[model samples]
Target: MKRIKNYFTIIAALIFFSGLADAQRSPQRAPQSKAIASSEDQCLFNGTYRIDVTESDRLYSVVEDARSSVPVRDQQQFFRDLSTRLTPPDMLAIECQGTRVTVGSSRAGKITYLADGINRRERLPDGSFVSSKITLGVDSLTFVSSGKAEDNVNVAFESLEDGRRLRVTRRIDAQQLPEPIVIQTLYDKISAAAEWNIYDGDRVAGKMGSAQPGAPPESNRAADALRSEFAIWIEATNRRDIAQQMRFYMDELQAFYLTRNTPKRAVRLEKERIFGSARSVDIRAGEPEIVFQNGGRTAI
Candidate 1:
């Protein structure tokens, strides 16, 4: 009887110790796994989304209805010209992640948007990280955006994603509206996206370096035009004057760039910026690498 009691006592002690060990290890193990999961799970919005052409609509009828108030020209040629320009976007690519949003063609250069109040990490050569927060502002009313944006532009960001909203926004006056008009674009995701954040920095010219290698001579000419334009733009940016930047870009690009860097106040260059100059980023650009198409108007 005494031996049996001792044996039972030893068994109980072994089980208790085993339970305690598991309790301690479980807490440690769960959180490390959770951390890894969270990092991998990420935000669903963090990827490159091209317009699902079959599922996307540009809403040209909204424009036509608003413009219907304009006296319809009876001339057939005028009507034909008007019809040509109103076609829906055949292809649109949008990349959404953290704060950066890119809108344009995959082959062509894209307009980059840095959202309002999101942090981006810059890793130094020494393997230290510093954070810079970016804010995106949009001014839909302006036909011109020289780095600075003004007047009644609608700007807001809602991050809750169930896969039915757009991160970028804009507004304008239309004849059909009693008030200003607003448009929200929606995006869809792709399966493989190891390179979504390609436009991480350098909003002035986005990812032009990716396809510049082995570029033909004619493409070099196109790239030169882009470089010369950027030279003026860089000077304007250095001057801390939005108006100065406008001189280099086309009217469409100026508005798009300014709109993307929204809330106007956040994107300004300080008069006492510490950097004296920026290093020239080497680009091996070719014309085919960047394709821009808007109503049959094409450019590199």
Candidate 2:
């Protein structure tokens, strides 16, 4: 258990060390959506995800009393002020295994522990205490915490019908804001790294790694299909079939490409020229991953 204690002690260090920002970000690969898991799937969050600050849509509100306090008009400033809580690391990570979950990012580094059994504060070297609790259920993961500077914190993650994205509502209690600030942080679920292993105590295990290939064939087929499609696309980099290739992108993305790149015919000609000059495109895919968006979309 000494090792476990040491590991958690390291986690505390990360929790405190999150203040330091480092330049340069590595590329992230997301798993395709399972897209069709049964409703009884309790382990929907059993993977890692990269979260970003997308334009807020339908999310929880922060204006505690819209009538009493003036609404925050300057969205950029508001988001900037709440950057620490909203987006510090361009890409955020959430790892959930069984009932335990860890949320990691640039600013808050990382925090990992049992979901239902954690309720304590870790005193940092700076003589300040960071306290938090995690409560996991069938459909939601609730994290409640507060620090020396914070009055109260509530960040809730709700699982949609599909598992591609989670609706996050964060409420930070700081005296700096006009009132309690509520921010909507929607996290698009992505696939974890292939060859990445999850260590449970001393028992070593491989997840989405080569060693565990086809361990759960049914669940992995969708992810595999996505990979296969990508491989095919790579091989066909010099492909002239615009119709077939256009199918590679989502409608929203296709529309964006058409608009941003110019006329459809011109875009096709550009692709042809680019691919025609390429010698070969290499496919460097790792283990397969899966994510199911609520609207029946799959992203890999």
Candidate 3:
């Protein structure tokens, strides 16, 4: 009887210890992930969004009705430009990641909204990483109205991933009606602003006789013409038009050196002269900057 009782006691002790051990070895509960939600997430930087501009049927009709108010040439450009900018069916999904906004139409894989913004990092399927930073601000706004015309109106943004800070502004006419009506008006205003920004930048860079920073001390006409020709030549090459490529240099040589030499010779000589005077020529997205190769190349 004593031995049986002792055996029972030993079994109970072992079972209790085993239960405690199992409890201790169990996995712990993970912390819940947090999400930042806001009423204004539609315009958040890097926030994915779907906007339906076509939902406002009345507004669309109104714009169409007033199309005749604009001049014939202006109307042609306006409709063409607007058609290119806005997606069909009035629905557009945009991912505001970094300085870029990847816009999609009704379905997926139709990315079109590429604007000036900070660079982003993309991970490849093979595990490699690529980073592209947008130089200009992605969330810039310029407002104009009958009474008010302010340039910068920065707004605050909080990063959901890393808690980084971002700023933007809603540039629109202050006297505009309520949100429903103003959304349409604001969309037009903002689109114009973006287009104008790009146009102005390109125009300034493309204008003949425009001075580059740190270029050789040549006359404005010579340097500007050379740059303008170079731009055309590069564009022609990119298009892969052999005739255009030939004509670019031919025209340049005739205009600058007063020579009707072969394309190869003209190109070689032009390159030599340009490089001889250039310490360093920086070809970038913005304005081209040059440094003298020989002496100090002051910007002309």
Clashes of each: 10, 7, 15
Ranking by lDDT: 2, 1, 3
Tens-digit per-residue lDDT, 136-240, candidate 2: 666677766666443356667776656666666766554334465566656555554311222121111113344234445544565557667876765555454
Cα-based lDDT for every prediction: 0.34, 0.46, 0.31
Instruction: For model 2, give the 10-residue run with minimal summed lDDT.
Output: 194-203
Best by TM-score: 2
Q: Which residue pairs collide, candidate 2?
A: 30-191, 31-191, 32-291, 33-291, 33-292, 62-182, 164-292
TM-score of each: 0.30, 0.40, 0.20
The reply for model 2, stretches above 4 Å from the true place, is 1-41, 48-81, 88-93, 104-111, 125-128, 147-151, 192-300
lDDT (Cα, 0-100) at 126 in candidate 3:
42
* 1 versus 3: better lDDT goes to: 1
Give RMSD (Å) of candidate 3 vs. truth.
28.9
* Cα misplacement distance, residue 51 of candidate 1 (Å): 2.8
